[model samples]
Target chain A: MRTAAAIAALSALLAVFPFLATAPWVMTIALFTLMYAALASAWNLVGGYAGYPSLGHAAFFGLGAYTEALWFNHHGIGAGLTPFAVLPLVGLAVAAAGLPVAWIAMRTRADVFAIVTITLLFVAQTLAYNLRGITHGAQGVAMPVPDFAPATFERPFYYAMLALLVLALLLSHAVLRSRLGLALLAIRADEDKARGVGVPVGTAKLGAFALSVGITGMAGGVWAYYLSFIYPQFAVDPLVTVAMVLMVFLGGRGTLWGPVLGAFIVAPAQQYLAYQYGASQLYLLGYAALLVLVMLVLPRGVLPTLGDRYRSRQRRARTLRADVGTGVSADTGGDIAADVAGEQP
Target chain B: MSAPLLEVRGLARRFGGVAALDDCSLTVRRSTVTGLIGPNGSGKTTLFNVVTGYLRADAGQILLEGRRVARPDPARLYRRGLCRTFQQPRVFADLSVLENLLIASGRRRAALAGPRVRADDRDRAEALLAEFSLAGLADDPAEELSYGQRKLLEFAALLMSSPSLVLLDEPTAGVNPTMVRTMERHIRARHAAGTAFLVVEHDMNLVMRLCDPVVVMAGGRVIAQGPPGDVQADPLVLDAYLGG
Candidate 1:
C-alpha cells in the first residue's frame, strides 16, 4: 500500500511537473531522467537483486539502440508502433547475445565472473567499433527526426519514452515479486546451498542475465529513437556501464526504487557537470568517491540506512510506551531501545 | 524388499598422491535412512561428492533405478531424483523464506521462457514451508533466521526438489538439542514418506536414532557396514574416532 501510494504520488508529480505549467527544459530533463531511471531499474533486476554485477549491460543497450536505428533508417519504422511492439524483437536479440555469455560465465565464481563480464564489454565494443559498413563504425548512424512539426515533435517522444519507462518499472516490480526473482536471490546468498535445495543454479542465473539484457536493450532502443542518433562510443562507453552500476548501488541495491532514484539523481548531475565543466568535469569522479564512502559507511545502501533509522525510531516509541507501563524513566528506556534497534535490520 | 534405489560399485577417487576415495561401494534402498559416518580426513564427504557428481570418481559406476550412470553433474543428479545439502548451509541469505523454497523446487518450465514458476508450485512451496515450521517467517530474509531455523529452511528447500534421495551433510551440526530433536523427527517423517537419505553426521546420537544401517569409513575405506549397534562395536570404527 505504501509503495503504491509512493508510486501514485511520483506519477502525479511527473504528470504535471514544471513542464505542464511552463518550462520546456524541465520537461526535457524529466524525460531524460525517467529514461535513465528505467534503464537502471532494468539493470537492477539481475545486477542488484541477483547480486550479479554486470558491466556488459551497455552491450545490450547498444544492441537495442542500433537495431532500432537500422530499422528506422531502412524500413521507415517510426514511433507509431507501440514501444511494446518493438520491445519483443529488441529483447530477443539482447537475450540471444546474453545467453551464451551467461552459460559460459556461470561456471566461474566471484571476481572471475566479474572479469569475464568486463571482458565481454570489451569484446562487444571492439565489434561495434570495427563493424564499419553496417554499423557506420565510429562515425555513428544518424536518424532523421519524424516529419512531424517541431512543437509536436519532442512532446510525443517525451510521452512515448515516459510510457516505456513506466512499463520497464512495472516489469521489474513484477519480477522482484515472483519466484524467479527469489531464486536469483537464493543464488546470490549462497550458490552451493541454493544448489543443494534444487536450484538449477546455472539456469536460474542465465534466465536473469537474459531478461536483464533484454530489458536494457529495449531501453536502449527507446533512447536511440529519442536522441535520433547513436554510435559505437555510445554503445560501449565505460561511463554507460559504470553509471548503471553506480545508480543501483547508490539508490540502494535490491530495493525497488533504488535504481530509479539513482538514475534521476546521477544522470541530471552528470549532464549538469558536463555542461558546467565541459570535458574536464570531475562530477563522475566525485560521485564515485561518494559511492565508495557510502559503501564503506552504510554498506547496505541508502534505502536500508533510511529504513534502519525509521525502525529505530519506532522501537524507541515502543520502549517509551513500555516505560510508562513499568514506571521507569522514558529516557533510559528510549536510549536502550535505540541502541538495540540500531543493530536491527 | 525392493532393489536398492542407488547402487555404487568400486567408487574410487584420487587427488594426485591422495586417495580421497578408494574402491568404496554402497547401496541405499528406498524409504530407508542410511548413515555414512567417518572422522575428519576419512573421505566420507569425498564419497558423497563423488556420488552427487560434484567430484568425479576415477573408477566406479553409479546406478540409479538400475540405469548405469557415468560421471553425473549436480543438475543431472538432481533431475535423476538425487538432491544434496552441503556441510555448510548455503541458503540465499538475501531472499525471503518462501522465495528460497520456490528456488529449490527447480521446476523448469522451458529453457528460453521468461519466468517459469507456476502458481501450483508456489502452493506446494508454501505447504513445504509450513511442514518445516518456516511459514511464519515466509517473508523474512533467509539470513535473519536462527541457525536452527536456517537448517530447517535448508530442509524445506530440499523438499521442494521432491527428490527420491537426499544427501544431508551434517544437518544437525550447530543446532541446539531441541532443534536436533525436531530435525530427527523431520528426517524420520520424510523417510517414512519413501525418500531415501544418505546422512553424513558427526553426531552419534542422531546416527543411532535415525539411521538403521550405518556404514563406517576410515581413511577412505568402508571399515564396517551393519546395524548401528554392530558398527558401533567394530574395533576399526572405534579406532577411527579415537585415534589409533
Candidate 2:
C-alpha cells in the first residue's frame, strides 16, 4: 500500500510538471529525464533483473535511431504517418537485430557476456560509420520536423517521452511480478540451479533481451525525432550506454523505482552541469565520481539499501511489540511473500 | 512386480581417461525407495548425475516408464517427473525459503507471463514450510539457513515439483538426526503416495531402514544387489567398500 501510494504521488507530480514549467529549460530537462528513465528501465529488464550486464545496449539504441532516420530520410514514412506508426517498426527492427546477438551473448556468463555486448556496441558503431550511402558516412542525417510554431514544438515530444517512460515503468513492474521475473531472479541467483530446477535459462535470457531491446529501441527512435538529427557517434554513443547503466546501478538493480530515481538525479545533473560549464567531459567525470561515491556508500544501490534499513526497523519494532505482549504482525513493507506468491503448483 | 519407474542400461560416462560410470546399470521399481551406496569415487554420484540429466552419458539408455529419452536435459527430465537434489544443497541462496520452493513449483513456461500468482501455490509453500520446520524462516533468505535446514529446504523444494522419481544425492550428508528421521518419514509418505526415489547415500543404516533393494557399486560398476541385509553380507561388497 505504501509503495502504491508513493508511485501514485510520483506519477501525479510528473504529470503536472510540464504544465507548471515556467521556462523552456525546465521542459528540456523534463524531456531528458523522461528519456533517461525509459532507457534505464529498459536496461533494467536485462541487466538488472536477469543479471546480464549488457555494455552494448547502445547498439540496439543506435539501431532504433538509424532505423528511424533512414526510414524518414529515404522512405519519408514519418511524414506520411504519426510517430506511433514508426516507433513500433523501429522497435521490431532493433529487436530483430538483437536476436542473433542475444543468442550469442546469452550463451556466455558474467564477464564474457559483458564483453560480448561491448563488442556488439563497437561493431554497430563501426558499421554505422562505414555504411556511407545509407548512413551518410560522417555527415549526419536530418529528421524532417513537423511544421509547428516554435513555442509549442517541445510539448508533443515532451508528452511522447513521458508516455514512453510510464509504459516502460509499468512493463518493468509487470515483468518483476510475473513468472518470467521469477525465472530471471532464479537465473540471477544461480543459473545452473535455475536450469536444474526446470527453468529454460536460454529462453528467459532471450525474452528479457528482446523486451529490453525493443523498449530501448523505441526510446532511441523517440530521441532521434526529438533531436531532429543523428550522426553515427550521436546515435551509437558509448557514453549514453554508460550513463544508463550507471543510473540503474546507482538507484538499485532489479528494482521497480530504482532506475527512474537514478535517472531523475543523474540526467538533470549531467545536462545542467554540462550546460553551465560547457564541458561535457567534466560533467561525465562528475558522474563517475558520483557513481564511485554510491558504490562506496551503498554497494547494493540506494533503493535496496533503504529497503534493508526499513526491514531492520520493522524487525526491531516487531521485537519491541513482542516484549510488550502485543501481537506481532506482517510487516507491510516486507515483500518476500508477495514476491513468491506467484507460481504454478 | 511392476515395471521399473526408471531404468539405466549400460550407462557409460568418462572424464578424460577415467570412466566415472563405466557400463553402469540400475533400476528403480515403481513406488519404491531404492538405495545406491558406494565408497568415494565408486561412481554413485556419476550415475545420479546421468539419471538427472546434469551430465550426459557416453553410451547408454535412460528410460522413464519404459520410454527411452534422447539426450535428456534437466528441464526435460523435470517435466517428465524426475527431480533431484545435489550432493551439496543447491537452494537459491539469495531468495527467501518460500521463494526457493515457488520457483521449483511452477511447471510451465506460460506461468512466467501470468499476471497473478496462484493462491494454491502460496498455500502449498506455507504447508511445505511447516512440514520442513522452516515456517519461522519463510521470509529469510535461504543463505541464512543452516546446512541441515538447507537440506530440508531442498527436499521440500523437490516435493513442490511432485516428481515421480526423485534422485536424492547424499540427502542426509550434513543433516541432523531429527531431520534425517523426518526425511525418512517424508520419503515413506511420498513412496506411499506412488512417488519412487533413487537415493544415493553413504549412510548404511539409512539405506537399510529406508530402501527395499540396495545396489552396491565399486570401481564404476555395481558389485552386489539384494535386500540391504543380503548386500551387507556380500563378501565382494565388503572387500570393495570396507577394505576387508
lDDT of 2 by residue, B146-236 (tens): 8988888988887887789899999888878988888888788888988988899988899999998999988888888989999999999
Q: Model 2, which residues run further than 4 Å from truth? A: A324-345, B1-3
DockQ, Cα level, model 1? 0.45
Report the lDDT tens digits of candidate 1 across residue range B11-111. 89999999988888888887779999998888989988888887888998899878877667776678668988878776777777887776766665352
DockQ of 2: 0.55
Estimate, for each residue in A35-149, the C-alpha lDDT of model 2 and write its tens digit: 9999999999998999999999988898898888878877675652376567888888888888888998898989998898899899999999999988987888888887655
For each candidate in the order shown, give its overall lDDT on alpha carbons: 0.79, 0.85
Residues A1-345 of candidate 1: C-alpha lDDT, one tens digit per residue? 997898899888776664563445555666677777877887787778778887778877888888878877777656454433676788789888889988998678777877888888888888888988778888888776656555544565566667767877777777666666666676677766566555567767887788788777877877777778887887667777888888888888888888888888888887767657777858878777968886898688778788988876786768677885687886777677676657667
Candidate 2 backbone collisions, by pair: A180-B112
